[model samples]
Target: MGLEFNDETFRGDYTFRNSAKAIARFPFPFAEDSYMYSVNMEPHLPGRPGSVFEHMFDVDEHYVAEMRDRAQVLAEDPLRCQSLPHMTLAGWDLLELIMESKARDYPQWFSLTKDGNRWHWINRPLQIEQSFTFLDETTLPYGPMEYITRQTQGDFTLQDQRDDNLWIEAGMVTTQADWSLDFDIGMSFHEWHAPVPLAHEMRVFDRALKFLLNLQLGAPVRRFNWTMTVDPLLDTSPENYPKWGPSKTTMTPETIGHRQHLRVELQTLHRLPRSNAIVFPIRCYLIKFEELVTVPKWARRLHRVVRDIPDELATYKGFIRNKPLMLDYLSKYDDGAPTSPGIWPE
Candidate 1:
C-alpha cells in the first residue's frame, strides 16, 4: 500500500504530530547516554527494512504537509531559495538526483521518465506533474534545485569545491535550525560552520572537510545532527527568531511534554555527477517529548543526555533556558534503569 500523507501544520496552531509508525522509526540521534561534537559520519547504506535509512531520501507521512509549509515559507521570503549563476548546473544535477532517487524508491507516489533529456515527472502526493527539458532552466518555473527540492523534503545546499574547500553557493534552506541561508549563502564550509560551538576547537569540521573533499560519486555519506525546538516550527531561521524565540520562555513542566520537540536532522551528502558539486540535504524530523517518551529506551537515554550535557552546548542549542524543565519531565521516564547500548529500542 502507498503511504498516507499527514494533513498537518508545523506552525501557528502547531498541529504536527507523529503516528505510531513515525515514532517507531524516529531517528533517535543518540547512540549512547551522552552527546558531544564529533564527525560521526557513516556510509549512506540501507538499514533495517522500516527504518528511515532504508532509502536515499526517506518520504514520510509529513511529505505533503511539509511541502505546503515550504511553499508558505518561500511565499513569505523568496530569499529562502537562491542559486548563484554558476551553480545553476549544480542545481540541475540535484534535480536529476532527487527525481531519480524518489521515482525509483517510491514509485507509487513519484515517477520520472526520461528520453534523452526530455523528462516527464509526476508527484502524486503533491499533485505535481511537469515535463521539462533536463538542464533547460526555461522549461521549469523555478531553478532546478528549487524545483525538485520544493517537491522533496529537506533543505538542500549545493557546495562548489575549489581551493580544497566547499563553497555554499546555492540552496533552498527554509527548514533550517536557526541558521539563515541568506547570510551564509556564499560562505565556505568552515565559514558557515564557524558559529557552531566546540566543533572547530575539536577539529571536527577540519576532519569533515577533508573527508568530503574526497567524497566519491555513488558513495554518499550521512550523519545525524540534533537540537531542541520548543515547538514544531520548521522555519526556525534567525530571520524569524523574534517570532519563535519567545516560545522558549513559555515552556513549563506541565506543557513541556507536548510542546517540547526533539529535532533530528538526517543530513546526507552526495557528489553530484555533473557539476562536481556536493549536495547536502538536511532532512529535519520532529517528535514531541510526550511522543518520544513512548519508547522507554529513548526516554531513559534522552534524559541522561540532556541532564549531563555541557552547559555551553546546551546554551548553543538554544534550550539552556528550559533545561531544568526538560529534565523534570524526562526524569520521570529515566527510572535509573540501564538503557541497552545502540540507538534501537530493545
Candidate 2:
C-alpha cells in the first residue's frame, strides 16, 4: 500500500481498485464501467519528476489542452504574458483560509495573503512563490481551469526537498448533471518523490477532510487527490456494467486517448488515498438521465432471506482470492430489492 511509481510505472500498479465486497456494491461503491481517465504522470525527463494527472469524461479537451499549453508558454515569458492571453483559474478558497490561519498560528513556517479570492505563498526570500484560485462547479461545457505548480531552488541542494523546475499535470473535469444516485471515487498514492504532497499525505486530518469534500459534491475530483497507494483489498477488477442505457461505451487506448471514459453508470465511488504529491482531475458524465424509479415499498425488504453470507475466509479484516464478499453484501440488502436478470444487459 506504500509503494511508489515513476515514468516506467505499470498499469496494474497505480490504477483504482477495491476489495471483493467493494466491487459487489458496484454502481453504489464503484462505477460499473471503467472510468476513462488520462493518467498523465508529467514529462518523463532527466532530473525531472513525473506526475499523475487525470481527465475523466468528456469535459472540453480543447480547453484543457490550451490551458496547459499557455501555462508552459507564460513560464518562459512572465513579462510578455501581458500582451498574450492568461487565464486566472478558479478553486483556492479553502487554501486561503488555511494559509491565513497559518500566518497567525505559525507565522514563521506559513505566510499567506488573499487578493480577493487569489492566494499566494512565499516560504523564502527567493523567487519561490505559489498561488491558487477557487473554481465553482460548472454546468456549462467550457475550457479547463488553469494553474501552475513550480519548484525552483537557487543554489539549493536538498535531495528530499522539492527543488527543481516547475511542473504541472494540468487538466479539468466535466459536469455529470444527472438525477441518479451516482457518485465517483478515486484513490491513488501521492508520489513520495514530491514535496507538495506532504501537505496531505503526511497529515491524517487533511486526508480525512478530503474524503468528506468529494462526498459533498456528487462526484470526486482528482485535483483534490494525491498519489494513491496500491492496496491489496482495493477493487481493481475487469469492467462490468448493465447495458440498458441508450449510450454505451467502447474503451480502448486510441478511442479514450489520454482519458478513459465510461457510460451507463448507476453510482460510483472514486477515491484517492495518495501518499505522494499529485493531482487527479475527475469528471462524471451521465449520458442519459431517467426516472428515479423504485419498486413496491415492501420490495426493499427481501434482502436477508434471499442473499447468503459466506463464512469468514482467512481474516475478515482482508480478503482472499475469489472470495464472494461483494455477493454477500448485495444479498444482505435484497429483502425485496429489485433484481436485474443477467440477460438484461444484452
Q: Which candidate has the top score in TM-score? A: 1
Candidate 1 accuracy as TM-score: 0.99
lDDT of 2 by residue, 5-60 (tens): 11211122323322232122212211112111222122211121111111122112
Off by over 4 Å in 2: 1-145, 148-346
Report model 2's TM-score to 2 decimal places: 0.20
Instruction: Report the Cα lDDT for residue 213, model 2.
Output: 37
Clashes of 1: 0
Instruction: Give a tens-digit lDDT track for model 1, residues 153-250.
Output: 99999999999999999999999899988999899999999889878888999899999999999999999999999889999999999999999998
RMSD after Cα superposition, model 1:
0.7
